[model samples]
Target: MKNILIVGGSKGIGNAILLQQLEQNKVYNISRNAPEVTHDNLVHFSLNVLEDALPEIESIDTIIYCPGSINLKPINSLSIDDFRNDFEINVIGAVKVIQKYLATLKKGTNPSIVLFSTVAAKLGMPFHASIATAKAGVEGLVKSLGAELASAVRINAIAPTITDTTLAAGILRNDRMKENMVERHPMKGYLQATEVAGMADFLISDKAKSISGQVFEMDYGIVSFKI
Candidate 1:
């Protein structure tokens, strides 16, 4: 079994990916908090990607950074710190972790790294100023790194719209809110955590060996047609 290291693998899409990963490999989970789930194949490691460098990541075959923030406030309401915080966890934090584990990733068999972004980066929704700016940076990072890390490592990202995760509970708290969100897409619903995670698992698997530098969209038509 391959050794996979997933940062922030304790919840939501991260946790869903972890569950799928556990079915096939030894998974090292790096996160600030413990996952609500338990597993015998899991090795949990307390790691705040923004706080410290990864430990002995040289042994990890793949590393997926799930660090991100959803700051849905308007541009005027958002402070400079809001954008700063978004970029820190969304882009900078992921970079720091990847750099720390560069050697290990290079050591693995066709090492792959996955990062998360949001559909707002490309869709340009209101109240997404702070996060859209930050996730935009993440997109740039993924493209640049994918070019630089080629042959030895593959890099990709997924950008989804308003996934049904705790991070956006406020947006889906009631029927009115949920209905408004669902209507935004032709599919008329937000992505389930399991659904997005399944997409992620497919990317990391050997089946996607030739895939790299692509930003996969799982937005349920939010990024395109609504008809």
Candidate 2:
């Protein structure tokens, strides 16, 4: 079985990914809160991605960085600190964690790294300036690092649009709001946390050994086509 490290695996897509891989993999979850789901193979590290030190572990076959922010505000309303906070959490935090564990990842079997982005990074959503800018940096990190570490490790990213998660509770709280989001996607359905988790599973598996430096947009057609 592989040893999988999931940053921010306590909730949302990260939690789902932790659960998905528990049956056959040794999973390490690093986040501020403890994970809701318990498994024999799961190890939870209670720490903030931005501040705390990661547990000393080696031979990580895969890492899925799932921590993100969804601060939707118009560009004019966004403060300088807002942009900085988003970049710190979404980009800097991931980079720091990965840098710390890169050696361990190199020693693992077909090691792969997965990071998250947003459809807004490419689609130019009106009120997504902060997060889009941050995730766009994440996308760039995936490509540059994917190439830099190509011989030993594979790095990639997933860009999803308006996923149904606690982080997005404000957007999907009401029927009207939910309907508006669904209608924006050609598929007429938004992404679920578990579905995104499944995609993460695929990316790190042997099936995706040849795939790296790419951002897979799981936007339900919101950023790709018109309904």
Candidate with the greatest lDDT versus the true structure: 2
For candidate 2, the TM-score is 0.98
Taking all chains together, each candidate's TM-score versus the true structure is: 0.96, 0.98
Q: How high is the lDDT of residue 7 in model 2?
A: 91
Model 1 root-mean-square deviation: 1.2
What tens-digit string does per-residue lDDT give for candidate 1 at 1-227? Answer: 88888888888889888988897788899999988777787888886778876677447778888877877887789999998999999999888888888887788876899999999899878899999999999899989988998778989999988888888788889989988988988787889888988888888889989998989989888788858
Worst 10 residues of 1 by lDDT: 52-61
The list of candidate 2 runs beyond 4 A from truth reads none
**TM-score of model 1 vs. true structure:** 0.96
lDDT of 2: 0.91
Q: Count the backbone clashes (under 3 Å) in each candidate.
A: 1, 0
lDDT (C-alpha) at residue 92 in model 2: 96
